[model samples]
Structures are given as C-alpha cells and as structure tokens.
Target: MTHITVDLPETVFSALRKTPDEFAQEMRVAAAIKWYELGQISQSKAAEIAGLSRAEFINALFRYQVSPCQYTEAELARELSDAD
Candidate 1:
C-alpha cells in the first residue's frame, strides 16, 4: 500500500480530540463510506479500504445512513419473484 502524508494544523487535532492515527483511521472510514454510497465499490472492497471487517462496514453503513443494498425497487421485486 502506498502511504501519503497529510499535514494538518495542530489545532485541528486538538479540536477534534483525536490522535493522528485515530484521525487517519476515521478518514479511511469516511472515504470508504463515500465510495460505497456512490456505488463506486463493493461492500467487501469498502470494508478493506476502511480496515474493517465486512460486518463492521455494514454497521458503518447504518451509522452513515447509506443503503447497504444497491438494488432498486424493480430489481428487488424481480429478485424476490425469482427466489420463489
């Protein structure tokens, strides 16, 4: 994995009350959530990017108010019909 360094104001960390490592982890989770919401990545990929387990990522989706499933109403109905 390529590492990129981000320089932020000391006050930013103080204001957020998080250590640099903690902030970095939060950033990763935020990025993963955004990518998942945008339909740019699968849940597993998002979890990997966030350094979280699949179940953790699903919980994060709920926390972030993002839909876990990508299916539309019509697609969901079609799938349900097929399952029967």
Candidate 2:
C-alpha cells in the first residue's frame, strides 16, 4: 500500500482540539463519506477506506447526513415496477 504525508500548521491541532491520530482518522472518514456520496465508490469500498465495518460505515453515513441509497428516480421506478 502507498502512504501519503500531509503537512499541517501546528496551530491546527490546538484549534481543532484534535490529536494528530484523531485528525488523520477524521480525514479518512470524511474522504470516505465524500466519495461514497458522490457515487465514486461502493459502500464496502468506502467502509474499507474509512477503516470501518460496513455497519459502522452505514452509521457514519447517517451521522454525516448522507443517504445510503444511490439509486436514481428512474431506477427506483424500475425497481418498484419489478416488485409488482
């Protein structure tokens, strides 16, 4: 796996009241949420990226106000039609 380093102002930690590890974890969760919401990645992939279990990721989505569903209106209609 490839690792990337990010440089932050020293005051950022103090300002955010987060330790380096805590901040890094938050960044991972935020990235996962954004990618998942944008439909760039599947929920399982996002969960992996966020270092969370699938259930945990679903909870995170609720906390972050991101819907778990990614279906479009037409897709929903088709699904409903198929169900009937």
Candidate 3:
C-alpha cells in the first residue's frame, strides 16, 4: 500500500467534527464513491480503494445519495423495455 499525506486547515477538522484519521477514512470513501459514480472504476476496485467490502461500499453509495448501479436513465429505460 502507498501512503500519502495531505495538509488541511485546522478549521476543516473542526467544521466537519472529524479527527484527522476519521477525515482520512472519509476522504478515501468519498473518492472511491465519486470514481465509481463516474464509471472510472469497478465496484470491487472502488471498495478496495475505500478499504471496504463490496456490501459496505454499496451502503456508502446510498449514504452519499449516489446510485450503486452505473446506468444512465436512457439505458435503464431501454433495458426495462427490452424486458417486456
């Protein structure tokens, strides 16, 4: 695993009510979620990046108000119609 350091304003921690470690974990999860939402990474890869299981990542997606499935409205509609 690679280690990276990020410096942030002290106010950021206080504003989010998160300790540095907590903030780091949240950052990982957030990045993974955004990448997954963007279709830049698979769910398994995103979960690995977030240090979470696939199920946990799905839960995080819901928590962040992001869809777990990477499908557009048009694609979903076409899929539904095809199922008929």
- Give the residue spans of candidate 1 off by over 4 A: none
Which candidate has the highest lDDT of all?
3
Candidate 2 residue lDDT tens string, 1-84:
768899998898889999999999989999999999999999999999999999999999999999999998999999999999
Q: Model 1: clashing residue pairs?
A: none
Give per-residue CA lDDT, model 1, range 37-61, as digits (tens). 8889999999999999999999988
lDDT of model 1 at residue 58? Answer: 92
Clashes of each: 0, 0, 0
Q: What value does the lDDT take at residue 83 in candidate 3? A: 100
After superposing all C-alphas onto the true structure, candidate 3 shows an RMSD in angstroms of 1.5
**How does each model score on lDDT?**
0.92, 0.95, 0.96
* Candidate numbers sorted by TM-score from highest down: 2, 3, 1
**How accurate locally is residue 63 in candidate 3, as Cα lDDT from 0 to 100?**
99
Candidate 3 on 17-81: residue-level lDDT in tens? 99989999999999999999999999999999999999999999999999998999999999999
Question: In model 2, what are the clashing residue pairs, if there are any?
Answer: none
- Which pairs clash in model 3? none
Q: What is the lDDT of residue 28 in candidate 3?
A: 99
Candidate 3's C-alpha runs over 4 A off are 77-84
Q: By the lDDT metric, which is better: model 1 or model 2? A: 2
